[model samples]
Target: MRVTAVRTTRAPAWQWAGCAALVLLGAVIPVLRFLVFWPMDQWQVDVEVYRQAGVSILIGRPIYDAMTEAPQLLPFTYPPFAALLAIPLALLPFGLVGWLWTALQIAATTAIVWYAGYRLIHRGGSAQPLVLGLLAAPMFWLHPVGDGIRFGQVNAFIVLAALMDLRRPRPRVLSGVAPGVLVGLAMAIKLTPGVFVVHYVINRRWREAGTAIATAAIAWLAAFVAIPSASLAFWGGALQDPARLGPNMGTSNQSIRGVLMRVGPSGGAGVALWLVLIALVGWFGFRLARRAWLRGDTVTEVAAVGLLACLLSPVAWIHHFHWIVVAILAILGADPLRDRRRLVAALVITVWFVCRLPWWGISWIAHDWPPILVGRILQNADLAGALLALWLLAWASAREPRDAEADAVARAGERSAAPGKVERRAASEAG
Candidate 1:
């Protein structure tokens, strides 16, 4: 798991200033307009839901029984351990927590780039910060990422945890905490991260997988110890009811099931179709993921699995698509200057996500447009993006080095540019 660390040069003052400007334009302003000040802003209501769940724990109210205010009435949909963790937010003022939470999401997004795109950005040497700022500016405003910050969501933290867990020469965390512990904690907070367990099993990383399962179990046991009734409520039934998450047939839900629900196919046939599609995609996605790992591309392995999680989850909100950020880094394997095809592909995906294409599709539908087919396709743009990412990930990593001749050529090229086995070992891998 050792990586060849690149020697870094001291950044000039102008480099730091340029990086700050990019972040300010790309992230800070968007958060202010969309989340903090816009008339229709959600204003971090998700954070409010979390805080109220904390209040439920503190005041001895049933965790699931409590809901946010009218119009939304969002219930505490996370697991019991999340309620236990949210107690800290309960202790703080709502206003303070909202700002702090937004800051954390931004910081988490930065850490994600550091892990997923480390080699790419590090190549800039003294201009590394400037290059990162350039990447981060657009990254922060990605529709999915902006929405995550807008509603004070936790997806960024989960993304970071999963990436760090699988990253080569895994990044430092608490001493003796074990690698998969973060993945397990993420699962306890929201169940979607269970996909990573599937990834572990596929790669036969049995120790990490087992550690993750045990960690989640421990978190659940702790919650059960503190609030047996609440823990029972959540594990026994709350996790099963997908409807509690919201309208599955709605435009926001972009999973295979969600798309089929919107298609309005017949009953038994539709169920069969949904199940069939799920199996096909999961089998294909994981197949490629395993290949990427065997070929030594941990970045693509995680990115592929993360995209599968987003596409397969029964209720993927717009905010949950934050995985796109990581996928971007994975697709941009090696230097863009040398990989023009990868560069164009990455840029296309970026611009596609930057615009609110799905909402525009809905608006077209509302206006009774003649191009209904185009509108429908546009509406599912994000889901389609996930599928495209899976295929591109395979093309970019799993299928490369088609023969020893090509592999050797690629290796020689990498060696000429940088002197390290790590640089040649991975297609979408950490430095």
Candidate 2:
């Protein structure tokens, strides 16, 4: 009777704490939106772009030609398939849509922590809700994540979808769609996620690669069927225009090419330099990603590939760095706090990203400060961190020997499943 009474007394206190945690997580974006959005970004401007694209679809305006009203005048730069998906946002008032979009971003962020941070959450025992809520709150404020909320960007969804495609690779969607479909849809929406398809290919996930290709084609084809002109405009030329994204040399453009544009040679020389560097980055990044894969660390594998996408893109805005959220989880690994070194590394990385290092770099350059070198380094902080992360992940993965038994089993499964209907199922689980 005494134990039961004590347990009952603590139940409400635990529930209250859990509820408080949930509220804190929910408030992160709202607080950031009002108190923390940077001067450069217009509030939810990308959402406005998406909403306007939907309006374009409903009103028969050319999506590419249509620009958001006022000074920003941002045009729709995403593929036609994304425009097709935005039709629903068009139906709602912008005010309502903004609120809903913010909520969705929160949900997506929570889902990401849930998926990638599951191992940590699992060890929390009866305190999973408290653990999840607390973990999610800080993640929501990660610069990229906050930027996603402020700009109403689609990046959180893409990260979540890609994570699910890799982490939980067996589930179906809407009762029919397969594991790779989410990644496919993501690629169709924005070509950035095409990196995931490359991951599948290099790893010889042929069926998944094929499924992703087919799914992306279907989406683009569907858009082509629905709005042939817009489809043609996107695939024909608009997709190639990096200019539409923004100033390449600006602080927000954190890709390697962006760094080169700011500091390296210009014209043909810059192009050649970027190409050489990109080729090297691709080879090295993929090698590390594959290393994480062989180590059976899905979080690191996904994180490595995601970092590659951000670093290699022609115009990766700050919001795209949200991939760092998972990378942080990967840094922590299964043991959240047992290893002092790991905990400190994760903390440093988290703090490094939360602060706007790149913008500080820009401030120094703008002010003509004496130590311009320090500023220059700070300006490309995200890119530098990404490269360093790849190296560290590769090094860490190298320390562990390969699982010969698992490799042997995968090979055997591959052999028997070849030319068979269950090949994809076998191959997917074998790894």
Candidate 3:
């Protein structure tokens, strides 16, 4: 008996070649524009701060010492492990480091969009590339993303780390260990990501949560070994002094504390007000996460947790609002094509962020506008947008769906996981 040969189908040669070209252009264009054309004045002042911290470590100086030589006099505000991470950058020339850092940031931002689109929005087959391309280009222009790049801030990397922990595929052995370690490493670098430990707890991923805490502890110990004095300084004093970080009442500080400091009571009363707001937002946001988990929607859960972290942090600078990318993807994932209201709401939120309306509004308020209420609202646009996004997601998730609607979502998730019809069509065409 004769055996038949198997045939496999592939996209036409031109299609494959065109896709490769697009990917190359997409990566190269942004790096060239950001590194070469962007003014040197904007070449990541925060990165200089980090580099100096590394230099301090090497020279036996305290990492917390203010870099008085720098224009900003910015102190190294991150955890000691972060300073260790900066050592390589410290060894490089500033010019070379800036270019490399910008490129790394661009790659991180692209990864964030790709992960958000694929895992959150479930874009499969050829649609995945299109979705990634669409998100990647606009993502570079978003105020927070641009600001993060400009300052050489680590927010992009932090966001990427969080996504990695949250979206990593389950492995056979020690499945939870990888995610926990990633999150723990993130927290070791910057404290805000500790909020994810709460996420793991709420989800009842005990092993992952424990691993995260343990990993962080190990990192802290290692840093202590490496820089005993600096570690003590950071943990003993510098960490507590919010003033050392930056002006809490400034427009750049977009947390609830910032809002209260600007317009509400001062001193003890302001602190109390901020605590109350934090408790409320934290409760509501975590509740939404649990509800989203129950509904089998991890995207919403991630967005809610991220928003809570930014809103609750003492100093969530404009760059920290990179979490807005999560909110945008979650909105799109929540049946935007079928839900007109959600589609419109998502569009409005995207436009608000893309135009950097909040920062612009703060600038307007500085001109001594009379309508203080509107001015304050616009001035706190980042916080307001975060609240609105959280509310919309909570509301949408809370709505009891029709049986058919729930079934559709379930089916969509199933399809997202498996090969899509488009893939089949491509195969057939090739055959």
Candidate 4:
């Protein structure tokens, strides 16, 4: 009895310590290094774009006009509402705005990972394990997520919005309209998260998809009204400039074109390869969605949609690939501690983390290499990282017929065998 009392006394203390550690580590990434010390003046390629959009929204100029101006500022390429959203930031000094924005983003993203980890650990039950596992995930440590915080990127918000939608079923305008608004704003700002619309549609969320579409259209239209001719010109220029301005963009955009150029191949091959990848991944996603729908499995369907969106996009940046965090978390939420599968998932996540190591710029012997060698190495690492993310996404989407059927059967059994139905009542009455 004395020994039991001692063990019980220690358990709460340990639990408290564990919870504190998890919160600290989860927060440390966004608070470290460049994110910690980087000046607001030294914003990245996209941050500058957002800054321009913010400023434009403040000055009563249309976002599209600012996007298409002589200086060609605000590379946002997003819809009008995003500029409107950033308008508040424009009111503050860049230093203050960027700092506050980063802090808010970190908090939001941390919340998202915390909740997602909980769902995965508890299968939507208690959230203790979820919080702990998120603390453990390498991506939750030091990486692009921090870069996002430092640069004031909206990825964390995007992730949070999607997670909120998937966390439960809500039949409200907010439920349908909010995701659409978030996604539409994301699409307007970056044009990538537009894939979420496709995701909604494939999951038979026609009403939600329509709502998202309308929200995006209205937002874009608002931008158009703010600057009619300039909006048209900007759209035209965006289309016209791409052919002339291929891959001279930056080191970060070492896309298919970059690979082809490095290896002495034609641009056609690069574009062709991206197309092939999109088609293949699209087909795979279709199959997974179909199976999930037939089996009425919402969890797998949402995951497949997110994963396919990342894989199918032509220019998926490291931050863009963070959507896979959702995929892994979703799988874990749907299927808790099945040891073998968890091990495999862990292995894939480990490889992904290793490949993303350079993104932090806290390099080891690799960065110490000669400039040319380092560039090549970084390029290879980036490509490898993208492929690894795609591979994990594909692997996560794979469905064994037997397993899917068994899950379906189990769910069926639950419904049929549930307490106090008419059938149960009738059987009871007869007995």
lDDT of 3 by residue, 276-303 (tens): 9999999999988877756556556778
- Give the per-residue lDDT digits (tens) of candidate 4, residues 1-431: 01110000112455546655665566675566545555534544355566677787556665554542333233555544566566666667665666677667656655555544442432322334334545444545434465575556777777666555543222132433454565565566555566767766766767767767787777778867866654575566653454322243333443444444454345676668767756766777766655554544444454566555555654444555455555555444434455467547645654554455444332433456555556465554554554554455445545432233223222222233333222211111110
Off by over 4 Å in 4: 1-21, 39-45, 60-74, 121-138, 166-182, 200-205, 227-230, 239-251, 254-264, 289-300, 331-336, 354-378, 386-431
Better of 1 and 2 by lDDT: 1
Clashing residue pairs, candidate 1?
none
Give the per-residue lDDT digits (tens) of candidate 2, residues 1-431.
01110010122367547845684656565556643554444667899999999999999999998999776789999999999899999999887887788878878888788677765654554565676787777786567877788788899999998887876222223236665788898999989889989989999988878988899999999999999999999888888887888787888898989999888999999999999998899999888777677656677778889989998888888899878888887777655455556567777778877787888888888999988899899998988877776666665445444333322222222233232222122233424
List the global CA lDDT of all models. 0.79, 0.76, 0.72, 0.52
Model 4, global lDDT? 0.52
What are the runs in model 3 whose C-alpha is more than 4 Å off?
Answer: 1-42, 119-124, 168-177, 398-431
- List candidate 2 stretches off by more than 4 Å: 1-32, 35-41, 168-177, 396-430
- Look at candidate 4 and give me any clashing residue pairs: 78-188, 78-189, 79-188, 117-130, 118-130
- Candidate 2 vs 3: which has more lDDT: 2
List where candidate 1 sits over 4 angstroms from the true fold: 1-8, 12-14, 173-177, 398-431
Highest-scoring model, TM-score: 1
C-alpha TM-score for every candidate: 0.90, 0.86, 0.84, 0.70
State in Å the error of residue 373, model 1: 1.3
In order of listing, the candidates' clash counts read 0, 0, 0, 5
